[model samples]
Target chain A: MNILLRHRIILPVVSLAVLLAATFYMQPRAMSYFGLNLLFNLAVPIALATIAQMMIIMVNDIDLSLGTFVSLAACVTATFLNDAPILGLAILLALILSYALLGAMIHAFELPAIVVTLGMSFVWGGLALFILPLPGGVSPGWLRALMTVKPPFAPMAVVAPIIIAAVTHLLIVRSGIGTVLRGVGGNARSVQRAGWPVIWLKALAYGLAGLFGVLAGMALVGLTTSADANIALRYTLLSIAGVILGGGEFTGGKVSPAGAVIGALTLTLAASFLSFMRLSPDWQIGAQGAILILVLTARLIFSRKGAGT
Target chain B: MTNSMMLFSAAGLALIAGLAEADTSGKRIALSNNYAGNSWRQAMLETFESTGKQAVADGVVAAADAYTTSENQATEQAAQIQNMILQGYDAIILNAASPTALNGAVKEACDAGVTVVSFDGIVTEPCAWRIAVDFAAMGREEVDYLATRLPDGGNLLEIRGLAGVFVDDEISKGIHEGVAEHSQFDIVGSVHGDWAQDVAQKAVAGILPSLPDIVGVVTQGGDGYGTAQAFRAADRPTPLIVLGNRQDELKWWAEQRDANGYETLSLSIAPGVASLAFWVAQQVLDGEDVAKELTVPFLKITQDTLDEALATTPEGSVANVTYSLEDAQQVIASAR
Candidate 1:
């Protein structure tokens, strides 16, 4: 039991399973391929956003600007990426570089990530509004087709998350560079002592986060086929919730790519389950909050029990 | 011309067109609403449900279920619309999250032979029929009323809605145009209220400290009561504020009238426009020659009708008028 509890992924996996079971019980149709596809299609961008948040969290820093940054990326994808591909790609690359520079600045100046990102949130939101002031821009065709692809065995919704989890897990959990990056988050002093450049590691983490954020935004526009300045503003809170739900802590490097993916899926399913129950809209949002609290409480109880033994 | 004149002409055409015998008993309709966070939206959902129940009982349709997204996000609403399509709803009445972001899902629903009718936050897809309020006219009329009330106008403060939204842009444009035409009133200050009372109060308070004595406040709907509150808090003489048809706004206006004979105009698109969209979707499904674009008249309350509107509107809700099938047909005829 202690070993199982110590395994960070188990809690998120169990929580996801329980929620999926409840959803299936309530609406058996959700078990089919088509129904599952419909239920989970929007989860793709959410999972990507969660993973992006996880990358920032892995470095023990919070990003309040992630939601607006994603919105800006989507705006870029819908406008520049559609009409002028080269300019769009260059802008996206510049955005990622800016994120890396931001990380470097934070580390060098010993600034609070929260305050910096909070200020940047407004900048990103303004830029997004400037890019697509009114919510009207056609997504590029290839991107749209890529997002809606249908494989034979499982739907793209399920397949996409699996691929995301697997690749991120391999890159962050198995590689040598992964060890150095985690070391920077776990103990920057010790990593610097060992001759690993802590500043570069933090920059790398933030740059990776930017990459995922861009992907999340592009995926969102592909699904909606257009962009709005405020389209993904809710993602900041959702991504933070996803990270915490997946057994990641606030001031530590402990994070699980698989657990975060499951957490995103669980959050998405919770919404689908509530819609299936057909609760009043007034209660629906409250019920969703209740579900989140229940899952977290269960995790707390199990962790306490595990510690006692 | 005023909306009443158009309605009178359309009523005659509707009677001559004769759309009473259409057969739509087997079709199922669904309301896909994006947000229900405010009093206005709550009133909208309630109106839709009550009107749907009546329609169902009269055998006008098989079902009229309403679904609102938890998060007011385009992605969530698109998914909801797709689910409605899968559930075999013959028609969908939508209050979209964004005008353009939901085009893909709406197009898919259209391809599946589902009739889509969008109102309030209407979609931009050509396949969907739109029931839009002439929001620009609503804004322009507010200034026009203020011009009549304060012929030699002083400084005015403009309270706008959520930024980056098309509705906000349109209304603000109209207000600016009205100012351009009137030339007496100068908009000295402007702030975004996000069409919420508390937000409006806070925004107005933030900007009022620097402005000169204002004679009027121009506002989008859902912000009038808040603007009044801010003026009271600032201890400034209350301005002749244009109001949205919220119960609280009307009630405040009434109290002010009793105390000081404050006369101002109140107008808003009725929350029951959802029912109009519903009936239009039904007409489309019933094989009626409904035009792709239709406009609903905004409800207006003047000093004379203030008491009547207040008595009819529920507390903490928006003023509303449920549209019957005849009203929908009249609107459709007028559009044609």
Candidate 2:
């Protein structure tokens, strides 16, 4: 591989570095343990959710129900898990099973992934509304404690994202099963010709997505210490954007867990940075969108240059 | 135009009140709610239902019906209102989706001689009677309270409600207006909390690092306890957090005061105002003179009142004081 091709991650990495530098330059205290904790505390759940979306994207499928499913898990965590531990555990497991079943059903009917997930979003959202019905529930004490755990020297919020990325990268990039999953997404016919059950691979990918989505939901509850059925609805679009921003390709099999994590962090920080800069709430959404588009456009130019060579 | 319509309704009401033999038995009242996503809205719906049933028992109204449009859409709510009108309901108690989007439908209802009582997110139709707490006043009052606490002027983190929302805009403007009155208090930063506990907490957490020493926080409803929790979690000295009237927030503030001498004022639009709206509709149906616009006071929960409010408030409920039929009468009198 050429030098330019070898440094494929340089664009996203450089963009992330620049953003970090700018944020720290403006608010130097953000480099401190406490400051870092305050800044990145909410990113853990977002990173996990992005990874969930990334996994589905790896299989060339989009999970529109991802955010609602996370909300469902959070509702369960805040209500059933806090009040009735055993029942909550059962429901959470059942939720993951349902995701796997959804994947199998989609494959069986050769349905458009978008339609199926879109339809299921309501199903999951309805179930969430049924369970909690209100934006009020207490997360368990232990979970709350877990979210607020302060380590010496560096903040857990800062470290957890790196560890999450590394572990996901190890599982999906280095391991043999990872190859099968990506292969199924990239070229299902080729994978099937090699005696791999493409159907099972698709289901496993969805199952992994569900697992990560559950983690995201629990992490979110931990941070806020409460649950609402509609709290994380905005995450569906954000997670998708994170995946795309992180160098994840839609044609399938090309995704970087580290890039996805960085993408999520970048998006989270963009909003926080806008708030810090004292921009009006009306401009925050538009400003964040502009930043995402700008960064991605720069990355695209870099990729084009590399391809041209 | 709405003023003239209001005057017309007021005259009609006065005429009805003057007639000693006016009958209101077997009148139907319908509740049209937009969304049921929060505990406060659920509480509002519950109060509306209960108050309606009590009215039924007293033979003041024949039946009370409620329809909640799961989505927060003006078109959907307007459709429901039209349906209520077609059903020949005498009154429609509405928590509207938009301020002006329901005006046409409300006018239709008014034209059909249906008493339209709107509250919370109210309609702009002058023909419809509105009952709500003064939101801008709540914001200004919160800042006034904070100013007294911080006489020397200090940095304040403003946790505004949902972005682009009329309530958020009004209350935020009021906060700024109050802050303008006292130039010492500086708003270090501001962010939209979407009026949800978790969202407010997370948004606060994100911006805390960039902010200086925040002496106090002013917030809207559904956000107070979570803001307090965020401070507690960060291991920072809890500041003068002005609260919205959520029962959990009251409970938390009480616990804090008991444990550590923490003190703060709480204020919010009471969910029971729904019941007040109900009583007003019923009174209007009973041929009693009622004002077209009723501005109910928000619940002001202080250290002295916190205990009583929390004691009566059920778990998972907002801190509220229910208004009685007598209280409704007083409100009507005051409005007049």
Candidate 3:
């Protein structure tokens, strides 16, 4: 049990497995391939958003604008990307560069990340609203096809998250640059003393977060086939919750990429499970709260037990 | 005619129509609602459940299930719609999160031969049947009503709905058009209330100190009560505020009317339009020649009908009227 708790990924994995089993038990039809596709399709963008949030959290910063940033990206994708692909790609690239700049400014000025990102949330939301005020923009055909593609042996919903988890794990958990990046969060002064560029590392982390946020928005638009300014606003809270559920902490550089992906899937399946339970609408939201509390309590208990010995 | 008489006649017609053809007995229908945080939406869900239960008891549909996304996100709603399709529901009655964001999932359902009927928060997909309110007209009419009360049209405060929503833009456009036509009324200040009473109250309170004396407040429903509260809190004279058909708004209007004869207009989309969407989905599943688009008339309350509306509307709910099959057919025929 101590070993399992030490692994950190086991908690999220067990939570996801339990939720999946419950969902299938309630609605046996959900065990089929198409059923899994329908159940987990929306989890793709959510997983992406979670990874983006994890990136920021790993750097010991929280991004309050992740939701609006993703919304802005979706708006840009649906409008500019559909009409003029070159312009859209350029704008998206510019957004990532802006994120890097934001990180640099924060580090250079010693600005609070929460306050800065909160202010940027409004900026991104306003920009998204300006671009697609009426929520009517078509997604590009290729993006839609890619999102909805039915790869054999597993649905895109299942396949995409595994790929995201594996790739991010390789990049953030198994690389030399990743060590430097994590080092910045672990002990910035020590890392700077070690001759690593702390500001550049922070900028890289923010840039990667921006990239994942953009991908999340694009994947969302691809699935929805259109864009709206407020389309992915709930992603802010969901992504934060995903990171915490995946054993990522707020103050430390402790994070697990695979666990975060599993955490996203768990959150998605929890909703599905609740729906299949046919709880009344009044209790449905409350039941979701209860599920979150239950899982977090279990996590807390396990962690405490591991610490005591 | 009295409201009950009209309902009785509509039900009678529906009974006759039901005897004539009942091809939807085996169909299963689902309601994919995005949000239900407000009294209006709660009323809508309740109305749908009650009406759907009646239909099932009468063997109109085999099953009528309703699912609402916990988070009011288009992505969540799209997933809910797809799950409904996979669950083998023959039809889906949707209160969509966005006008266009659910089109992909909606199109997939259409391809699977599922009948989709969206109401109130309607979708823009061509394959789905839309039961929409003429919200712009509702907004225009608010100004027109105020025009009658204040002929010399003074400064008007515009309380809009959520920003960036299609409904908000349409209604605001209509209000602006009305202001253009009237030429006497000027909208001096505008604020987005997000169609919530508390939000409206806060926004109005924040802006009232800066504005000059306001004679009338033009609102997009759900904000009138809050605007009134803000006026009271600020010790300013209450303007002639048009109201949404929320029960609290109506009750407040009644109290003001009784105390000082404060006369005003109340108008909003009935929450029971979900029932209308349900019937439309059933009709489409029954292979009826239903049009892809239909308009639902917004419910309006005047000084004369205020008492009646207040009496019928439950406490903390909205004024509602569940549509019968005959009414659905009438709407379809009108569209044709």
Q: What is the DockQ of each candidate?
A: 0.39, 0.01, 0.49
Candidate 2: true contacts recovered, fraction = 0.00
Fnat, model 3, is: 0.72
> What is candidate 1's lDDT per residue for A1-309, written digit by digit as tens?
325525678889888888889877877766877767777777899899999999889889999999999999999999999999999999999999999999999999999999999999999999999999889898999998998888888988899999999998888877899877867778889999999888899999999999999999999898888999998898898898898888777775777777888888888888777777778777877997898899889888987887798
Better of 2 and 3 by lDDT: 3
Candidate 2 per-residue C-alpha lDDT over B65-153 given as tens digits, one digit per residue, 9 for 90 to 100: 77775346543455456556655689999998756546546766787789999988777677889987677898899999988878998
What TM-score do all the candidates reach, one by one? 0.79, 0.51, 0.80
lDDT of 3 by residue, A1-309 (tens): 335525688889898998888888888878887788878888999999999999888889999999999999999999999999999999999999999999988898999999999999999999999999788899999999999899999999899999999999889888988878877877889999999888998999999999999999999999889999999998998899898888777875788888889888888888777777777666767887787888889989988997789
TM-score of chain A of each: 0.96, 0.96, 0.97
Whole-model lDDT values for every prediction: 0.88, 0.80, 0.89
Candidate 2, A142-214: lDDT as tens digits: 9878877877777888888989999998999889999889888889899999998877888888888999999
Model 1 lDDT per residue over B262-333, tens place: 999999899889999988898888787888888888888999999999999988877888898878877887
Candidates in descending DockQ order: 3, 1, 2
Candidate 1 lDDT (Cα, 0 to 1)? 0.88
User: What DockQ would candidate 1 receive versus the native complex?
Assistant: 0.39
Candidates arranged by TM-score, highest first:
3, 1, 2
Which segments of candidate 2 are over 4 A away from where they belong? A1-6, B1-336
